[model samples]
Target: MKRHLLLTAICIITITLLNGQAQAQNLRAFMQNSGFLSLQTDTPYAETYLSVPGNSIVYKTGANGKYEGALEVTLLYLKDSNTVAAFDKYILRSPEIDDTSNITFNMLDIRRVSLPDGVYNVQMQVLDINSTDKEPLTLSQGLNMHFHRDSIDFSNIELIDSYAPTTTKNVFSKNGYDIKPYVFNYYPTSVNKISFYNEIYNLSKMVGDEDVIINYSVKHVQKDAVASNLFRFSKQKAAAVNIVFSEFDITDLPSGNYLLHIDVRNRKNVQLGEQNVFFQRSNKNSVGELSNISLLDVNHTFVTEIDPDSMVYFVKSLSPTAEMYEREYISTILQKNDPKLMQQFFYNFWQKRNPTEPEKEWAYYKRMVSYAAYNYKTAIDYGFETDRGRVYLQYGPPNHIDGSDREPGAYPYEIWQYYKLSNNQSNIHFVFCNADLVTNDYALIHSDALGELNDPRWRFKIYNTFKDGNGYRNFDIDYFRSTWGSQVDQYYGK
Candidate 1:
């Protein structure tokens, strides 16, 4: 069975403004939760983190005559039969502001809940208390927490924004440190380092006071291999509870999806236990060193065997899996129109992924590209250039697809569900729609996957519900509530 450890949930909220009429306003917020085990107490607990931008909410005069925004946050953990296992409901208030227009800070909240070892469905709801909207934003996902008492296990990795020696015992304090949770798994250009906290339990039972090696590294999601420069290891004595509070300098890390792995190895160099968390980096300045490509020897290599024209097409097909910097480099190589340069770059790309089997890697990817092209080609674009094709090439095939072409009051839409993504994400979904209807090409409008398009007003586009004067799509809550013959919500939720 797979474990559901770190989960990042995104919710879209509809706030109703009251001025004798209800106006729909949209707000987006992020929520993340992780489960951990307390060996000392023999208990399991969960930590929930929420981040809501202050400017996205409405502020009203408070009891102290100051403008403030408040959100009523609720969390519910349900069992297999839909029975509530644990729940929490509370009001999270933002800092008092002198002017609502200047509200630019994010309101962060943390909650800790104790739960036993079991699988659960977690539901979260958030509502702006100041808004007249009666309905709140809600989202649900799965959660699992299981740690055997006699076997070595790792707690879910918690990404940290900042940490210092604990001055007071608070909800954020853990293992003598006051750790601020980095709610999002996304790290933009401004974030230069990645810090995390994790715990290993029952090590003493397995190793019996023997010294073990703790190795942690950042691995590229596509290559499934550790980055050469980002690996580290340390020696420690096995104990009942071992803690790892460390960080890696990601200043030079390129923009791509990656996994941070924590592994425990026994004294005899045997594997014991491992845990990994997914994250995305966006460092636009750290482009691939294209100048180094000239130094690579492509003579007699696999790329030399391909015709010049075919090599260009093959290089273009790499867009789905190429990093931001690599894509930029590929464009340069294509513009240069140098066969040797393109072959060198192409061979190097596959070589990085599979040092000993670059040809095998390219052969397999060539097959996938051909398949995607054959199935998803559009009128003017190749299958790889289309949205659905791009997604298929990038993430492989979906586990299930719910496609509807004749739904009432809605465009042809399809919801593709992936039971699990290669990056360790579970139950991910992608929403695609064909508005023109004539073309079979389905454009991706929304997705719950990290680093993909996430449009809160996706339903509006699919249903053709409402648009403002400027022809911009706007979500109409009233229409959604009264509309008939639309099962998109049901299909998407499933």
Candidate 2:
């Protein structure tokens, strides 16, 4: 199993002015971390990637009288949450800037740490060295590294931003290539291709004297089906460590959540091992595919059996799980209200999900839609239109829910935790709050899941505390402090 790790946190800091006055400001940066195993030395290691927007930090005049920004970074791996197993501390400096106001580039840094096989708690601390804030922005997550030398396994897939044949040895150099890691799994329209690197270990030991087939493909997260025009394979002689480095052109891929899968097989096509990495893509150009809907035929399809009046509702319920392009097509179909178009589009939707049994797929989804409508509907909206309803329909039921209704200084809130999402994201969380205090409708306030609303100061909105004299919520105050008689922190972390 691939142990994927993700941790994102934001902090506000106070910067000192030239005249010694202090001003509060937002310190914005993003960090992405992953772990991989080395087959050559039979060791495990962790990689940390940090990206800081140049405009978000305060640049100071250094010893050479040149403006530059710096961050103090500390990484700690703790065993059992108490004993430190590994630690790293260093200063990361940004490129020198002649004019601070025109700073538009991003500062990037990468670090690697090796460790023994065991589960550990990883803590990262980052501070703006140029700012007066004494406290650092801290975030923590769990890391598990377990690779056996006797069995075939795979390394965590590392997405690449850029790569070149290595001329010199450095932290980013691997297998004679200097790879710049793509810090985030998100790919916007600007990124046309997705490049990745992975290693298959102990293939020779597992499949002696046989050629192995390496299959890689991008698959839809919801459907678990290989995406069209995105599969590749190669045959190679068995080796102790096999490197797979490749890229896929996603310029025309639809906007949706997807997984890049790597599978190994023996000569007879028997599956050996497989791994996957989750990512999200946004491609507005892909919406042009909806124009092909007019070419679809639903005369003998399952959609034709549906009642005409329920066609729009059934199509609209798909908003929670529909891809970006599908959502647009749904809006267009609703506006046109052409029953033929709706039938064709609806049938094509399930056919794309489960080509062998499209009707069976829709049957399962119909039950879920009914469940959401019965449980989460309100006066003005159907269940699928509500935030909680949408989340349930999109991600399925959460593993755990922490609810509190009468906490002092806090509104009725529920924290939903999913042990693992369909996209391979683990330990995801969503926060919902009922501010109106009368209805069962709870609005989604925040979440730590990818592509979801992430509000570092979400507690403030739930508690309705920390407001300025202007009657507006004061967002500049401490973010993670627990208010009196509130258990939000505990609920969120749990």
Candidate 3:
């Protein structure tokens, strides 16, 4: 009986030691080093960490305060839309590390994986055996890593033809001031030697001099910075003149998005033209891989990309809905009973919204949609819900604007001014004056007031006239007669 009791005690002590060893080997904290950050292991037990770029790592613990015997790690490289799902799965299996008492377990080795040259994020998880301890710790990290390839001369890349250059209007306003007119277009990349041509005779109407200053900036998506180069062009003659731009080689740039801006100004340094454009260069394969390159479709009116084949395909995917209007019809759509026509509707919908190149317009269009969804989403949300958002998306920004809560004579009013008018400029003023006024007695209404109201049909008021031995008769209307809705009209329109 004595020998049996001693043996049992020894066995129980050995089992307890084994359990403690397992508990100490559990995961502590997951560290993701993006080639910029560093991770070190300090746990009592040896650990192994496995990783794949763009995927999260999960660590689970058991009820005994540790993982089972050996932990296995699976690495998955996500493709395209699988990002979110992968992240969620990782989070579902993560383990909770109790740092309250400062009792830390072993840390796994840090694993580094190469990622494509683009924006990406990595998540970490600790999977505890207890279902209750499965809380994942997620962190967002980015890698602006450049995937370089052997420099191949792109001199052979040629522009067979270019998109027909178009022009449109944009307005820039500060306080109550209006800037001059300006035109914008996508910088055509098909041709080796690019040039911009313009005539400036009509510009004299806004500024005393015929000369205008042009400023430009290039947005490089991968770099997250604007190009330092700025160019200036002076308009001197009524005759059409062309200026050639510096040669560009996209061979070194990563496959991603880009944008360019063109601002036209007069001698006064006032901004005449400020236009934003979006462009994208895509390689079906990785950045280092020699792959087929394509340009995304843009929908802006004046902006056009050189790839017409893609443009035609992009235009053929619009679906006609009950929301269609006469003005929304496209020349590309004539099929009354085409089954594949749904795609064509997609094309037309975007084509109509194109302010420049299809791709350029598409970016802004999506951004506008996003802005609307963020700012104006309601139980009944519409794309054109807010007046400010509508004007912002459709016409960019206004040149001149005035706003007041009071009516002109009784309430408030706002006025907008535009110094330059063209396809690019539309100046507007918003007036808010109460049309109703009860006088003590008789009052000569100003004739200008009658015309100002624009319709003898509507009720009128008197301005600068005397009533009850007092001179005060100024008539006004509170309705919106000008285009783009009056400032007060915006209140009612909303």
Candidate 4:
């Protein structure tokens, strides 16, 4: 039997996930949930590994079957909150589209950096080198590292996508280790094997002349059956410094979620240290056993006590999601007229989001929804019905908002500046102008956010108005960009 801990895949989300990342740059940063890897070899320091999301870069076709895209990644190892210690910049370009359609480049851009032992606030920026107007995508992470001089220790487990016996040396291979990193924790059906590498230091201090017992296993999530908990493999480490690099064929493991578990024990079989990372295996060859393991859905055992109509309204008030899958779900449920079932679905949705406290989560969001309704209500619509209200509810309030109502011949307009939006974009502005001119219904006319209105001529639309004996007329202007303001403070009101 293997001594192990039952890791609820749910608990892994307690800490700040990709949501804790910095705001978006030109490229929407797509990082694996656990993309950082720190490993120490032959020194008292470690090299950090991070995988930047690929495929998000705008790819264009070039002549003769080539795909053109350029990315510049800058890593700043901050000494403190405001001080920078070291930096690394990598410029990557793919001149050819080896596989254009496999756009989900899960393990696309890999970055490795060497630094001395200390905690660092890692500020990373990914920029589309092709565009001069696009903002550089930026994200920050805290990098904490410690190396003991006289104690047994292990480096973070590094996942390798594939490996082969090497006869020569290259950037991807070191000391005969020809390996490609498995950036994300996802292993599709095409990925046949899983390999990992890690370094152990000063192990002789713990075991003396005896060997260090290493247990390597992959356990199914939350399953306590004997087969799911049995031992996978165990090895003896007979050296002070060990580079444990090996691969295992996972073709037979049924398609499901698993943890590649590693445990280091002393000679007495007492667990000394352990570390593991989450991974999802998609083994299509497996029988129908894993069919039910669809997208992670909580047990549909809970129900909402709210009335059906109120529940529908609550769902409607929820932005982004309400406009997306949540809306479709409610529409389908209107046919069944089963409030209990609807409640279950609603309960499960939030439960999946904040499993520890779904009620608290709902309460907080409900408060925001109520606030939105109160502030954005108009003659024919509720607060949540307005465009500004939807954006406020969906992306939350802007960091700083500026407005101008008395500009000559200009519509009452406002610019909402968000310092950051959900690990996506930062310094983004939403320009809302009073399109109706009746009540306070300022509509979103243009924005610089990806997929949002990016009209360079927004200035003309906002200011190209003249009161010609009637209301106003659509017209033009001269050097509005220059007369408006400087580049940094681009707000219209002087």
Candidate 5:
């Protein structure tokens, strides 16, 4: 009797273990939660497959009368491999089942769903749970996702600039739209870039429903024709947008021109429109006026905090953006007569920021200031109070800058392009300033000689006045340009 009891216990344990192995339908759960599962499908006729939600009753026809049944399903995803190990899975909503009779296929047919543009994989399975016979069925397939293209139209469908730097309005459409502005940056002398702001309107219309795409580029005038970087986008909503492109700095570019090419497409994968903007960069440049400060001839007295040569470049860069009085200070006092003293002055300026060594954030700061001075200087101040100044002050000069400048009053503006920042981005823009003539027009034209405005705000106001004003009114180039060559030549070129 004892031997028989032990044998019965062993048989029970063996049956339980076998039942667990036969019900090992866990691959479905794995596919549902992993990155490999993708619901996106581009093909319309493609069939889908999925396992039943659980080990619930999914009966099938059998050979005997009293409704003998069995459960088994097929999954294509597992067909390639000889054995099923582990896999990710997802489930479509199962249909409510009133009866399982004659259930030839008891698995859910998997269908593809729309997903954002990216990469993914899919899988499905069928479980067997009847008649104590047959293996489970499973299927799976792989697919790639491409964004859906929807359509968007500018409310007015008119090509016009409706906004300034600080403010903009899209009045043509009462409902509103999407517009993004892209700016490109280039070297101090490159003119091949055609800088323009691209407006992407009506993006909000497709935001959640579909994807919107736009491609933008630029081409140089020469046969070598270096093109602007390609830009892509998806639109799904209505949004007003503006993108600025900067391929070169206006100040350093030669007088030749370039072309801006904009190609726009929508969610339905339709090309909405294309725009060609002709941009030219010449040599005559104007920047907002900047403040001028006089320092004692410290040329002979050296400061150790900052290097002397770097200080000179920093100061020279600022001269082009200074006001008339500031220009006079730079030309007469800073650049012309006293190189030694100027170096000491600039060296001390940075040393004040860097009282300690190796903690040199000042190197980046000074380079940005130099960049602002070089690109924003006007006839009076050079290019100083530009978007470049704000960015330079914010993040410093980017890794690269492409530049170009046009004669004042000839093309109405200049531009600077910043490309490939540490953060992986690009920008471009037209530079303008009206502050040069605001306070003391030039040192020669200063209304007050003995008591100059000591306030920084007054200096900025003078600068803004030049930046905001048109070249026909506020720009004066004679005192500074005379040092380069003939002032009359520049004046006529403008």
Candidate 6:
């Protein structure tokens, strides 16, 4: 029986997979800007999301003369490069792609798969399931699988999307745990809290009747000896494949590499077992400490514009420019109750960027602020406070936008397209949804924006399945496949 590897981790990378070399190197389909989520294998059941490029698969005109593709995917948990254990599956797809300019333009076909635990070199091959005249396309890559076969072990740490007690047995529910997994490792400033899942095992073997104190801490790992504590908590629980699910507020922690450090100990405080799972944070508010850098005002000419109410809107307006100043620095400045310094710093901020015409620059941005307020503001929230408003202020107007209204049975959503939001990203699209059914306060649900919310399962979010506690609809995957006329693949143009 196949266990669904349904752990969703958002990972983004640029690919021009028009050739065999590009096709041979990767199997990921819609990963955005995060690392692949790791899954532990020792459990009786496990699941994850995997993908293959549609173009990589060989296709042909059927007996009916319609183009079709078939793929066979297999994973061999490796003992070295040699296979130790294996799982395999076959898939047939009808890609109704009209863009014939590039034969590989149908886009990647993502699928779910299951496997037994071992280190794996994932291998995949594709063929036209109907026509057998052409050679099949093949690719392979190594993956680390710590299927926690240890006597005293833990499951792979799962970043939680959401979880409630199981009321229904579905894709998101397992072993009395109804949990959804996030698609990315990098958490930005907007993500204030982090929730995750891990399972403890063989505690009955390590200890007898007495309960043990289990501790878990999120430590910001540094190159130096000092690793600051971001969050710490402990609990007492019995031994077994014990489910350990916890959430921590990482909003205050500086952006960097961090590890969730876990330790199991006895009543004497002696450690029984320990493990760590590493994750990266890209919160601009948490990026780096920039409190000391002074913008030397050769001419403090604009000092007259400084005042107490500047706190009311100046930094609030400059929230889009979070890359320059740390959140703590700004918060610290605001808390100090010093109006003059804040104004001086604010004036220097505009002057440094546009020395000759600082007023012109500030005025133009303020117009964007006003525009955001007019378009995205709610009864209580300013435009800049809303997701669409913040995105408007930060990235300016999108060059193109698609899907202005809700689908027949889907949530109200808009797809904003940017020609080039950053040096590394081109033609990125963000999917914003009015999940609350509000008119002007659409939240940024998912995007391919380089450093934005790059949820891989956007279709799930767009369809509101996540609200009902399911990762997807009954046949949403099949629905997405049937609807891609020609416009869908345009979002991923090279």
**Winner on lDDT (4 vs 6):** 4
In candidate 1, which residue pairs get closer than 3 Å at backbone N, Cα or C atoms, i.e. clash?
none
| TM-score for all models, in order of appearance | 0.74, 0.75, 0.22, 0.48, 0.21, 0.42
Best by lDDT: 2
Best model per TM-score: 2
Q: For candidate 5, what is the lDDT?
A: 0.33
Name the better of 3 and 5 by TM-score. Answer: 3
Model 1 over residues 1-494: C-alpha lDDT tens digits? 23443344544545444542223266556777777887668888878788887767777776676777788988887654255778788999888766654455788888888888876666678898877665777754555677789998888788998999998798778878889888888899999999999888889999899999999999877655776389899899999988888999999898777888888999899989888877888886786666578988888888888999999988999999887668878898999999999988999999977899999999998999999889889889888889988989889889988968988677899999999877666788899999998987899988867557655446767777433431342211212332467777777778
Selected candidate, larger lDDT, 1 vs 6:
1
lDDT comparing candidate 2 with the true structure? 0.79
Positional deviation of residue 327's Cα in model 2 after best superposition, in angstroms: 2.8
- For model 5, residues 1-494, the per-residue Cα lDDT tens digits are 00000000000101111321322223231112111112133221212323233333333333332222233333222211222322334333333333332233323332333333332223344444442534333332232222223433221111221224323453222114322221111212323233333334435544543445655554443222433233334333334332323333345333333444455666666775554433344433322111222343344433344465655555655432222333344555454545555654455444444546422645565566766666554454433444445445433454433222222322122222344322222242212223333421122111110111111112222233233342312212111212222222232222
lDDT of 4 at 234: 51
Local accuracy of candidate 2 as per-residue lDDT tens digits, 1-494: 56555556565544444632122376777777667787667688888788776666767776776687788888887764456778889998888756664556778888888988876667677788877766677765556677878888877788899999999899789889999888777899989999999888888999887999999999887655787579999999999888899999999888887889999999999999888777888886776557688898778877888898899899999999898678878998899999999998998889977899999999999999999999888888899999899999999999998979988777899999999887666788999998998887999988766457655556767867543432333212324455567787787777
Model 5 worst lDDT run, 10 consecutive residues? 1-10
lDDT of 6 at 253: 62
- lDDT by residue for model 3 (300-372), tens: 4333432444444333222111111211232323334332342334443445445345456566655665665
User: Which stretches in model 4 have alpha-carbon errors above 4 Å?
Assistant: 1-55, 58-67, 79-82, 96-112, 189-192, 220-231, 248-257, 281-494
Q: Could you tell which candidate, 5 or 6, scores higher by TM-score? A: 6
Q: How badly does each model clash, as a count of residue pairs?
A: 0, 0, 65, 4, 115, 18
Q: Model 6: per-residue lDDT, tens digit, 1-494?
A: 00112223322223343422222222333221111213354333334434445554444445564555555543333333344444555564647443323554433333334444444444444444433334444433333444444356665566775678899787667568776666456677788878877767777767766778777777633221223455455656665556667888877666655666667888888877765555667666643324433544525465465456754576667766543233345676677766655665666667756889887888888889889888888887878888888888777888876764645556777778887743323566777877777566788876644335544445555665343444243211211331423233344343
Mind giving the per-residue lDDT tens digits that candidate 4 earns over 222-315?
2312113434545666566666776667776665556666677887788776655556666657543223323334354333457668887775
User: How does residue 286 of candidate 1 score in lDDT?
Assistant: 81
Report lDDT per candidate: 0.78, 0.79, 0.30, 0.57, 0.33, 0.55
